[model samples]
Target: MLPIKLENIKLNQQYKNREDYFKKMGEQLFSAGLVNEGYSTSIINREEIYPTGLATGEINIAIPHTDYQFSRTTDIFITVLKTPIAFFRMDEPEKTVEVSIIVQILFDNPEKQPDILKELMEIITNQRVLKEMIAAQEPKEVLQHFQINN
Candidate 1:
C-alpha cells in the first residue's frame, strides 16, 4: 500500500485557481522528496492537455498526475478545498466541473499506475465512499475511510 502522509493531507485549503493549487502542491511534494522539481510544471502542463476532473454526481473531484519519471516514490496527496474550483472534465475538456477534492497521485513505478488508477477511480466514483470522504473534517478521518475501503 502506498503511504499517505498525514502532513500531506490538507483540509479547507484556499487557492486562487487550479494552476495555483497545482504549483503549490508541486512545491510541497518536491520539498517532501516525493517528486522532482519539474513535476509541478509537468503536472500543470498535463492537466491542460489531459484533464483529470470527474463528476461523481455526489461530489466533484480531480485526480491530477504527471509522468512516472517525475516522481521519486509512490505517494498520494489529498486536498479538500474550502471553496470549489473549476476544472475541465476528463472525458470532455469543453465541459467544466467544480472540484472540491483534489487527489495528487505520484508514482515512480509506471507499471502500477494503471491498476492504482483503476482502484482509485472505483473509490472516487462510489457514491457512498465519496460522500464519506467529502464529509470528513480531519485528515485522519479521511485516511481512516480510505484504509477501511482499501
Candidate 2:
C-alpha cells in the first residue's frame, strides 16, 4: 500500500504558484517526518530544470519531486487546488498546462520512483477516477478513492 495519510491530502487549496504550493506542502511533509529540511528547496530547483506537468485529456496534473536523498521516507502528498495553476509541461517545457492536481512524491528509495510515477500517471489519466477525486468533498474521501482504486 502507498504511504498516503489522510492528512497529506489537501482539498481546495490556494497557492499563487508552484513554488508557494511546494513550500507549503513540503512543510507539511517535513512536519510529518516524510521529508528532510531542504526537500522543498530541492523540489523547486528540480522542477525548474525538469518540469513534471502532464496535460491529460481528463485534467492537467503536476508531479513535483526531487532526489530521494531529500526524503526521510516514502510517501505521496496530494493537493487539489481551488483554481488551476499554470505549470510547464514535462514533454514540452515551452508549453504550459493548467494543473488542477498536484502529486508530490517523497521516496527514500530511488529505484522505486519509475514504477511509482508510472502508476501515478495511470491514475491521473483515468478520467472517471480523476473526476471523482476532484469532486471529493473531504481529504478522507480522496484517500478512500485512491485506496479503493490503487
* lDDT by candidate, in order shown: 0.84, 0.85
Report the C-alpha displacement of residue 27, candidate 2, in angstroms.
2.3
lDDT of 2 at 138: 88
TM-score of each: 0.92, 0.92
Which regions of candidate 2 fall more than 4 Å away from where they truly are?
none
Best by lDDT: 2
Counting clashing residue pairs in each candidate, in order, gives 0, 0
TM-score of 2: 0.92
Clash pairs, candidate 2, are none
Give the alpha carbon lDDT tens digit for every residue of 1-150 in model 1. 545778778888899999999888888778878888799899999999999999878589999989999999988888988889999999899899999899889889899888778767766677776677677888887787567546
* Residue-level lDDT tens digits of model 2 in 2-61: 668897898888999887888878787788777888988899899989999998866789
- Candidate 2: count of backbone clashes, pairs at least 3 residues apart or interchain: 0
